[model samples]
Target chain A: MNSLLVSLRVALATMLVCVGGYTAVILGVGVLTPDSAQGSLITRPDGTIIGSRLIAQKFDKPHYFWPRPSAPDYNASGAAGSNKSPTSADLTDRAKQTVERYGATQDKPLPADLAAASGGGLDPHITAHAALYQADRVAPARGVAREAIVALIERHTFSPGGPLTPDRLVNVLELNLALDRDFDPTSSSK
Target chain B: MTAMVFILLIVGGSALLSWPLGRYMKWAMDPDETAGPGRQKLDRIFASIAGTLGTEQQGWKRYMVALLIFNIVMFTVSFAFMALQQHLPLNPDEMKAVEGSLIFNTVASFTSNTNLQHYSGEASMSYLTQLCSLMWLQFVSAATGVAALAAMARGLAGRKMMGNFFVDVQRATFLVLLPISFVVATLFLFGGMPMTLQGSAHAATLEGLQQIIARGPVAAFVAIKQLGTNGGGFFGPNCTQPFENPTFWTNAVCMVAIILIPMASVWMFGRIIGRVRHAGVVFAVMLVFLLAKISGAVWFEQAPTQAFASLPIEQATGNLEGKELRFGAATVPLWAVLTTSTSNGSVGAMHDSLNPMTGLMPMIGMWLNATFGGVGVGMINMFIYIILAVFIAGMMVGRTPEYLNRRVEAREIKFAAVTLLAHAFFILVPTAVFAVTPWGAATLNNVGPHGFSEMLYEFSSAAANNGSGFEGLGDNTVPWNIATGIVMLLARFIPIILPLAIAGSLAAKKPTAQSAGTLGVEDVTFAAMLIATILVVGALTFFPAAALGPIVEHLKFMV
Candidate 1:
């Protein structure tokens, strides 16, 4: 009986320290870094909350760079991958359709990352190579030089230093926002 | 080339950190050791609190009872919080109460430190429950395992009494887990992981659509989730979620965090028993398995997924489906192996979308489980395998089995055998029953061998206290929740308690003087024996299931 009481006291005390104390400390520290603490929400010039720098947004228009295919249609609230098996016919059919949609020919193939769905469905970035592959469409649609669009992608390409880091990545939303800022694509195209 | 370098960095970085952290853990957990005035004050406070609760040195039976009772309290508290979460404060999203069986399953899951989630966190759980119930359980449950391990190590060291359970729990929580978690959580916050009580943020996209971007106190949750080997994510896709794991550096940090403590645990055990050389040999064997699995996973994932074989896309980048472009193909497979190997089952990519051979690597990790396994309990599991190896070697050499100068008689072997057998039994038996029933077959998101692999992986994860899943399994059903819940509970307590029992039995025996005939546990030959024992036992039990699932799937893909 004393053991049970001890167990209870131990559980409660541990909970207070771990859940209460630890969280309070982090939350307090979090206030100092408000931008990240509040989900890194990005705002427009007019101060409208546009999106997060981390989360992927849907972009199918020719003027903007598209992200990887999303199983949840880029639903941030319902993040998930397609979770398709390698041998599943449904998975194969979907991949084939994605390939067809990308208009990949023998000479000009889509990047594998572009043809595949991301794990979270809200993957914000694409490979720099994948972004470069779509330069022709984006450049024409935005009425910008192809070289300029490629240059924009290069400027946006990010690689956290080290051999362990993934290859250069370009955040699709950031590049599109940059396009709007420089080229005024919404006014120019639409 | 970069992939190989990445693997080496992660492994090497963890090994480097483990040594110093192991020494600190020894200092913190030791009853007689004090670092400074601060530690002495903290120790006095804990001692007084324990004194109020009757600070008697507990035997194995008493320790087990205290543990069971504490876990029951955890289960009850978590269940109440989850079930009544709708009525609780801090639920800014007004999330509803969880369903009956799911509540049971989740409570059992976190209480046992298995953390197998049947529901997505962003959609299903309230912030109150996430912090107060689930996250609370994550800390205490991991501390429970660490405390149990400390007691078991003391027993093996031939201490007349295992340390007081309450005091050990206090030390493990305050001294070890909390301090490390605070630092890691701070790092995660700086890496752009959200740490807020606010509801999911509303964002108007550039495409003029509303996206409810989920955010909460994730940085805090993820720190303990990885550090404690409790991989219950604050979001459904776990670390795959960008907000939870924002960048390559965060990805590297999470991967390193997953294995750091578990690696440190082997050295902690060595310090406890005063057997650093033996621990070094054991650590080397575990590292060998870990490197081998990492190599296999990375190699296998280099193949374009069979599903995309005929698609007119560049497959040279390897299986990119269900993988983040930011982390790429190499890091995902590495994370898969590391997470499973350590029983820290957070994923950077979907295991279900992995190439068959790649998927096999994680399964193999869970099957052998002791390749630098979960924080403290992993070392306990490895100890079970060591005893079995010792007994078999003893039989072969025509002498008595002894470890650390303690005789491993029939009782000890029986305890070890039961613990080993129970793990296989819990995993295989339910998988067999469920694979044929509506319970399992109805929930599968893939057909054929991949379908079977989902069920096998679920039970294996549950039984191994690994929470990572195929995720393709639509496993939020009542049957899955209930069945896996029971398996997690049994698998957790059996391995833990039985090892303690074995340690207790060994403690009662007089240390026999070592002779030339006695088996040397710290050398290469014993390493070979231990490796062989793990492979033979693990393979013998799970080979048929493996053949049916990933092996057959790989063959089919080849054809």
Candidate 2:
């Protein structure tokens, strides 16, 4: 009985060791990477800070690339999706909301994924096909000719191995950053 | 959708793998079975260094303590390696530091054969970090699995003490890892997996010359990662890499290699115990489940998903989203089932894209704790469950349970039962709540029954300590990250805890005399009874989730 109790203690010690180890590691990270009360502010070429990586801002403008739609929205730190079964009413409701959101985005209806999220709401890219649907609206909105817009869209399309649905896309975060770098506001539509 | 199905296939395929390997072990471990010259050299080395020091006759509690301490130390070191990777000598390109949370998950995951990865391989970690921290764990964890395998082998072999924990861990590493890794790694390198740290040539992205890409020492780690049944990747994109997974044949070979030793331990079981039929029964049972899930996935693949149904994608080629064109519907799940179902937790095909029902298959495998395996531990876990089942069958028949001189007494039965029930309790109760609750419901990525099923499946898989995801659960948040971490720890240890208790109690019990009323667990009757008990328990526990997830989702897609 004493040995059993001792064994129990040993197990508890082992568990504690694990817990303590993690706590220490976390503390180390806190010191090294130091949690910021504020997220790093990013900006357009205009020097105006837009937002932070920690925050998910809605990108509905035609000229800006879009991210995967989020449930509970794409913002809210540590926010997540409803773990609903495919047949549940909750999902249908959410989809309906997403569909409505998608409808407001452009003349064309939304891509299914455009209205949904990649499991980790942290997903940053939209599929090319989904991205291209926005090209028409963005081309005119930016006063860039449709052909030039098409060319930029073509430039962003990528295939890693041309395998596994080879259409996995340019991440929205990187793509938007590129837009800020290359797009010149002084260009005339004429 | 492709990711999810591949997960199921790999899981189910892993189960199928256990059988042949089990049968082979049965043949190989016999004293009468001739060791080829090479095997003799291998065996000799294990004998010398492993020292066979553990009193195969030591009492159970002591053995359990040794095993516990051994694993704890291993996890600690593995965790430290990740946390301290920047300081580690081997790190190339000064790999970025892994967040403690990711380290916590991988350490817990790999030790448990769960192999859950929160970070993308290339983006988050360096080659040195992958090798020392991730790859080292893969090797040692495989040893840990075989250690459990050997412990269970002790119970079956009718040893008095639970056997030497150190010997088992060492021999498993040497006897299994050294040779198996050689074959597997060589095959991978031959199959075009790269071992060098030279960055993959930067090429134009489909649209244009884009980001400077990173590829790593994939060949070396890819071999052990899968063959060791450690499912982490050289690159975060994982087995999705052409360099890592490569051609379909390479994927198949790697998949088979991972399960082969874990499954072979069963044959080792029969030989060590001098009972060929006993090993065969376990091997057979694992096969049945594997085949069932594999076929289920194939059938599901042939059917188009609603998401696809709404799209122009052809069903003939199967759902392509998140699937590697190299492996196709057939190979990915075969690889997936092999990886996730065995505690390998590695992914060659993205499980994020699987149709809800097809996706549920691997979830089922993980939820089962891949009882058929985590390389070494899978066979051991099933054996422990078998003991519990035998004890139950004996109770129902108004007799005592006796196997190889160990009495399956009331105490042993109680603890083992607690372990089984506790695991089920964890999976089912949480799943039921998630299905019913608003918070859980709001988390669904897909709508309809299929989406809800995925949510339940994700929690179940995590809670079960199986790391494969539906890729549907929007995890990485506080609620899930914390809940899952807790679940993974519990799922990994609780089963181990009760078994060790059972071993202790059995060690203390006097061998009961065999009589007409004593149940012979090795007979066809007992084996069949055991199988029925396992299925019923599994079916009863998981059927609701299965109905809500895979069964409902399958009908939705097919009908």
Candidate 3:
């Protein structure tokens, strides 16, 4: 009877320790708020609502802005990364194919990160170079003068030092929203 | 490529140094223990405590069960921690908790001594989550291993009042892991794994909007991850990041810490059983195998890959896949050798970057399960093989075999063979299945021979209970997560269970001293025989697969 009591006490003690420790961890990670999430709004052509700051959707009209690579399904809940290693041949070939599809010349140097997917596959921004490549095509579609679009870019481009070429980049999501209001009021991409 | 070289470098040092250091540690602790005053003091104190606690001596069978139960409890704790992370505190960034399917794999990986990682370190985990769920379990899992080590000592030393499970675990953590982890963890922090959950790196990308980069409390977790021989890194990049394993000293420290327990505990085992030279012999054979591989990796990586040279790309740099700038080519292989040899999956080099020939060393190491393995369990596992080697030699010579002063028999050998075959099966069958399947082929990070090598390396790592990968496998998929989890469970427990059962059964055996006809275990001949057993039986099994993978790659690059 005494032995049985000791065994029970030990088993109980083990269970309690495990439960207590486990609870501390669950509360530690699960309860935390996403306070750092940066929220932004999209204004439609008439200055009404659209969607989010980070999500990526299609830019259908051959005249609109393009978003960076995203693994998420337009910010769907079950969205996930392709889970491919950066060194994978499949990814390397895919990146190369994408570059070719963008009509980049064979000799043009591509940004390393541009060719590789982000670990989460939901990277929201592209280098100024990537944006600039699309700028020529996008400006012609909107009937906006090159200098005017470049000036809007100059105002919005972020840089720690003073003005620089790569520094005058624009956010795709924000830029697209601005395009909807400024011209093409009937644009439907949200 | 840089990380694989770092691994090569470490293997060079560990292979040359571990045996001598192991031998020295044996002599340093006690040259001729006529039973020192300190030993007596520890003994008396423990005995008194046991008496007061009303501890009853149980047979080895019951003790093994107790140890397994303790391990299961640890498993439960880690899993619960993962599930509950969402509601828990210390999440300053307020990151959402991990999903359950991912949580199951993560918990199993950490607890089973295989540290395979599938998630990003900074974004997915909170500070409270990192320390409590992952780091805390590292502590208990390491302690559970050492408790089993003490049980092995009892089996050999033939103690009537075998050591307490709780006491052994507490002592291992308090005396070994906690103190060492404090110092090592601090060093890793000094090397720049983050200690605080201060604001993450802030910036705007070329776009005017603010972009956030992932950073967190990695320094504290890194110490145990490396020291416990758990290679699952604090961040997704594993050890390649400057913050996680930064600088040369920290690199060396990580290497040293991974092998410390496995190396030092051999001396501890010798001391407990009163056979210093016996431990030295086992340590020596392991060193020879390790050193040869390290040199091979170093040589292999310095040579340029054939495909890279043939491509119009500049061929000056060697083996560049997934290689980080911080450590460069030489440092990668050094980290590789240490991680694989110690049951750690922590990688400094991208296994994808390794020269095809270079990948073989780690693949072989994981395939055989390092002779000295993860922390406490590693050294004990080596001893089980030594006993089996002795029994085999004795049977061949038509003599009764004795380890220390115990008879070897069919029952003991049966359990050891089960453990051996189970471990071996884990390495071979998994690699074969992956090789024939599209799931494995599609995940290939590099093409040709090295790709197959990386898949084999993953199985070798998982089955050996080492968690570090070649960083090549697309391990995030469901098949890998589930399959590797099962392998980790079986590989870890099977090795542990059989050794423990042997200990229990051996405790029942009456001591039978050696006669003229009986084989002598103490002499140099027996030592040579033991070395042969490890190299021939353990290593030879993986040779053909290695030839197909790393060896094939070597020939390709040369051609």
What DockQ was computed for model 1?
Answer: 0.76
lDDT of 3 at B526: 74
Q: How high is each candidate's TM-score?
A: 0.98, 0.69, 0.72
lDDT of 1 by residue, B1-559 (tens): 7777888888999999999999988888864544777777777777666666545778888888878887888888888899999988999888987889999899999988888988999999999999989999989888888888899999999985888778888888898889999999999988888999999889899989999988999999999999999999999999999988998888889999999999998998999998999999999999999989988998888888677677678878888888987775678889999999988888899999999989999998898889998889999999999999999999998888999899999899888888988999988899999998999999999999999999999999999899999999999999999999999999889999899999998998899998888899889999999999998987678999999999999998855
Candidates' lDDT values, in order? 0.89, 0.58, 0.61
Q: lDDT: which candidate is best?
A: 1
Candidates' DockQ values? 0.76, 0.05, 0.04
Task: Indicate the worst ten consecutive residues by lDDT in candidate 2 chain B.
Answer: B202-211
Model 3 scores a C-alpha lDDT of 0.61
Better of 2 and 3 by TM-score: 3
Model 2 per-residue lDDT tens digits across residues B438-548: 646776566666666656666666655555665555555545555566676777667766675665666555766767776765677766776687677655677776787
Best by TM-score: 1
Docking quality level of the chain pair in candidate 2: incorrect
RMSD of 2: 10.0
Q: What is the DockQ score of candidate 2, to 2 decimals?
A: 0.05
Residue B83's lDDT in candidate 2:
86
Which stretches of candidate 2 lie above 4 Å from their native place? A1-190, B1-57, B87-94, B205-207, B310-313, B429-444, B447-451, B507-523, B552-558
